[model samples]
Target: MAFRGSLFKFLVVITLYDAFLTVNSQAETTDPTKMTAAILVRVDQSGKGDYTKIQDAIDAVPSNNTELVFVLIKPGIYKEKVTVPADKPFITVSGTKVAETIITWNDSENIFECATFTVLASDFVARYLTIQNTYGNGAQAVALRVSGDRAAFIGCRIISYQDTLLDDTGRHYYSNCYIEGATDFICGNAASVFEKCHLHSVSEGAGAITAQRRESPAEDTGFTFLGCTITGVKTAVLGRPWGPYSRVVFAFSYISSAILPQGWDDWGDSSKQSTVYYGQYKCYGRGAITSKRVGWARSLTSQEASPFLTKDFIGAKDWIRPAPTSFRTASKPISHHSDGNN
Candidate 1:
């Protein structure tokens, strides 16, 4: 009878151990965020991932989301127009490889209506992807339109013919990006900083790289390119004034021979030549020669270029963050529709 009691006690201990294991396994599977700590969803062309469409994956994220949702897209050609709504903030759409993962469209109607990927949400991030509008040269086709404040792009390739990057309105940051276009490619009034980026102009004739539209002097809107490289197929000007008070600065950048000697254009309105603030500082290469630059454009001094040199120009220190490494699975799916406007 004593031996029987010992066996019974051993069986009880074994049962308790199995129950503890079951509860722990359920916790890890049900709420992985407790261990990994980020909301993650995956989009794949194959049936392996959670969603087949990228838009569907984005739709799964809740509106007015305060936490970061990391959407991992598998390598494939996504031929859909994607828009991040204004209510959904703190989202990151990342790709494994820029060359393989492409988001492309052939919309050539209007600049406002034709972007392949539009980011209308603040505190958004895009990484290692190519966003292109294949509307070659006739109309104003925008590959990417960023209208949200504090949007950031890393290792992205933005390509189009005219108005490639409609940096519409925001405090944006592009790092290690490749932006290519022909006319007014990088246009907008966003106070942006392009760091270590490559701007390639595919113009066959005369084209302007930027058309900054800062309407008033009071508006703190401008474009600042630092440690960037500019190349082109044919001659192009550094920028033309899309607004009377438009401002642009290129500092510590490499300007290729494709740039026109005048450096800037008045956009046929000579009045803009005086109001537009076009400046260059410590830039090297054949196109950066200031001797033939327009009289209106300035050769900035060290003191003048100080304000535009760092991420501080856009107050990036407060909002900009690194790509997250850990992740949690997505929860509570939501629905949304795109009307082309945010």
Candidate 2:
């Protein structure tokens, strides 16, 4: 009986130990810290980072990547055109400073091919970078083309002449960024929210700020600017219809004197004036005066403006997040220019 009792005690201890091991294994597997640790790579123009070119660092990330890969670009003007392919998701290409880190190109030929920086991957983020197409004042040159879904831009400066930001096809969010262009600058079919951003028009004549391309009422796509500031070198209209059923909204924003009194345009097609949905709600400034605005535009009521005023317009809360604070170095640090200087 004493021997049987001792064996029973030993078996209980073994069972508890096994259960403890299983629990610990499950805990480790489900740890958020381990799951969210980003893979870090650096890019420097002066050969001081993991890769000399921005594209090379991007290429190093494996296709269909599930982990967050942070591509830290050192300050300098990268003249090469860069594209983040669709397969490489969960990538953050960030610069230390906005003014010092520039990705520039001088392609003026085709609107489809001339973007300086293009994001084709979903779950992509670009922060504190100046993306510019140096084609001034004539052609359809695009500075930054974001065709990826769930992409976010924070504190970025996008510059060009026409079609500066092809906010293309995506559900996107732009926060505290500066977008500058002349004609039909911020145009596309994306459902996007620009919050606290500065839309500066460098138009010499009457240019349009946005050219939304929502073709049908069923399509959930439009451009909403909330708490944004609009300024320009010369007179510009708020937006025009790039598609028959285009939609755009500006709410609680500052519209500078650079805006035309006749707020919206129909893009030379009078028929578009009947179908496009352009509205402004509780906006202030000399440009926000709606008394002289086009008959088609609406002075939206509070209830009507409610939809465009929140991050829910782009459904950003589901995917939008800052780059992870913890990261594992993906490559050896090479000698690179650390000072963020132009």
TM-scores of the models, in the order given: 0.86, 0.87
lDDT of each: 0.85, 0.86
lDDT of 1: 0.85
**RMSD from true fold, candidate 2:** 12.3
* Tens-digit lDDT track of model 2 for 44-153: 77766788899877866656566677899999988899999998777899999999999999888677788999999988889999999998876899999999988999
Pairs of residues clashing in candidate 1: 38-328
- Per-model clash counts, in order, read 1, 2
Off by over 4 Å in 2: 1-35, 331-342
Tens digits of lDDT, candidate 1, 1-342: 677767755654454333222223321133212223357778888867777788887766546555667889999999999999997777789998999999999998778889999999888899999999998978999999999998999999999999999999989999999999999999999999999999999999899999999999999999999999999988899999999999999999999999999899998999887789999999999999999998999999999989999999999877787667676564323222323222
